[model samples]
Target: MPDVEDLFVEFETAAATTFRPPGVADVQRRIRGRRRRRGLLAGLLAVALAGPASALAVAHRADRPEPRPTPSVSPSPTGRLAVRTVTLPGVSGELAELRFVSARAGWALFDTCAGADESAAGCRRTVARTVDGGVTWQRSALPAVPDGRVHLLPVDAGTLAVMTRVGYLVTMDGGNSFASHPFDAPQAAVRRVFATPSGLYLGCPPDGVPTTCDRQRVLRVSGGLHFHQPPVTLRSDAENALVEGADGRLWLTVGDDDGLTVVTSADQGATWQEMPSVPRAARQLVLAPDGRDVWLVRTEQPNGVWRLAGTGWQPGPALPDDTDGIAAPGAGLLVVTSAYGGLGFVTGGGYVEVSELRGPLRTSDPGTSVSVLPDGTVVAQHGRTWFLGVGRGVDRSWLQLS
Candidate 1:
């Protein structure tokens, strides 16, 4: 018989010669396409060794689809939340994202199996709207979203901005009577949409590979989804992380997947100004409850967390080294990781922790995550199950998410 070691050596040589891992740019492009899968192995690996908050920044590169996973609704004696089930009409997958502009209005995005069953390659997408909070949802008419991935933005009580392959869809009278406008020929592919107090903007990354469409630009739309003159300076196909400030100005964070930059645009995307305070190599960006900049820097080990205060950056707050996300979850507060895979809200003085978790907390689990909705509701996940913020242990009450 042939030597076993020699046969293994020969097979290893064949595999290495035939296979190669992708470079940073390729990974960035794929991240954009598969953002809805909850957590791709590569994305989780990026979070593991990439620094404290790289996961938060890179995770925003794209987005999710799935049916609503019903969790056990045992009454929480610690808080006022009564776990509940949310059903989406014709939902064939899991809920990718959900947000409520107020206690009354909200939206959800879903990612489903491409062909009746889930696929490793990609997925199908859908959107649902709710006027009486998240308890029930109905399909919202949208342009046939090829990948079912979309960015949903609430402009006001009666307005919303949606970006999909069918172009930019907007509803002025709530979810009823949505209007779609085709993007200018070169800017048709929808990358992202942001609804700011000043106006809403859509990111249009150039099509083609890095060799061809290597530039990325954003379109400013108002009154309707019409393109304004002049585009933003970001020139990569990777989706940029964006946030709006109370001043009606916008802050954008873009990266090469290996590093990130934060820039500001006061006159919309027509002009931009780079904020040098942010670390050039840092990948994570968080807009604090006070509208200040918070960051996780680049280090061999992610042990430091900083927030910008006045002239210099200072240690922002203390969180477990395993902290995966941060958000302003109402009450002049921030939702942080609590002990035993639970959560806490950081207010003016100290941390308000959520203790005695009865089940697996997805936000603390691998690949799963938590984020604060526009209204400061903290939503966490372990798998398909979701937990919404109700009342706090101190000075809070169970929410009426009816």
Candidate 2:
């Protein structure tokens, strides 16, 4: 089994190689005329050095200012970020979570018994992976578990921290093989795993009893496998989504019967700060790549209004109804997935709906997961299939609704 350090090295190497270096020709082209003059002057200077007249010409040319290197202008990844969807055929239930390590590689977890008939054989929990975008998906063998839920956190491009109802598993070689760890909490069922720059924090029941809901805890896993003491206790039940902000803070939606609560931690799980009031039940919470920006969507309501909240928990804008998922596609633009399974963009004026690239998706389908790659590709998922949809460029204007 490869260690986490090895995985980190691999991720850095992949990132460096995947991103092509800026083109030097474009830069030279920008200063082509100046470069030509400089080259001519240098040649004349060489001739002058060979003879008395050549020396005089060389002095004149030397007085001329040297042309600055042409500013290299590498065009940002262009075109509408393509969105593609791949449906896993054999999966029995709705997918609970979706995550991507890159534009071409990702993973999804579907419920095993969600749509199974009591008389029929129970559906097995499913985990599927894609290496070439979402064109094709292959089911990865999951560890033995009669009833379990899978949660994956991508540590890097080729490494993931996997959690099942039974225990924690680490995959260093992408999703090819998983090694189970001996670490186990009283509550083996982990709802979510938040991977931060520091370590992994798991949300689980404090005492293993669902009925004893008050005793919920956030287990902090540091040094990769070292266990920390006195888990971070929350006043309400934590939501299934956990995201680490770019500001080195951990953010998550925690709610019980009351309402939604957004919490932030600057010191890993050692300390936490809670938002005053989110105003609605949060079905999902996502942190922008910048880390300070956040978007929370309400799932229980049919209106599908999403509250754009972040930083100090101050509200930004209210998204239009029917917005099922919200994602930051770089800059200030917010890409929203509608309940009808269509895509749209939210601007200061209002929500501008994009053409439905997929289908008349079922409302019961788990809220689509949206992710924007470094190259500006917009990848979304509805249940078993992942979509590589059209891109709208990296600039904010390009992302504006048409």
Worst lDDT run of 10 residues, candidate 1, spans 43-52
Instruction: Give each model's clash number.
Output: 15, 20
Question: Per-prediction TM-score, please?
Answer: 0.58, 0.52
Residue by residue across 183-301, what tens digits does model 1's lDDT show?
33312112122223344443333321112234433433333332433334544334444556444556666655565666766665667666665443454555532244444443213
User: lDDT for every model?
Assistant: 0.42, 0.42
True-vs-predicted CA distance for residue 198, candidate 2, Å: 2.7
Residue 15, candidate 1: Cα error in Å is 35
Residue-level error in angstroms, candidate 2, position 20: 33
lDDT of 2 at 15: 18
TM-score of 1: 0.58
Q: How close is candidate 2 to the true structure, as a TM-score?
A: 0.52
What C-alpha root-mean-square deviation, in Å, does candidate 1 show against the real structure?
Answer: 12.2
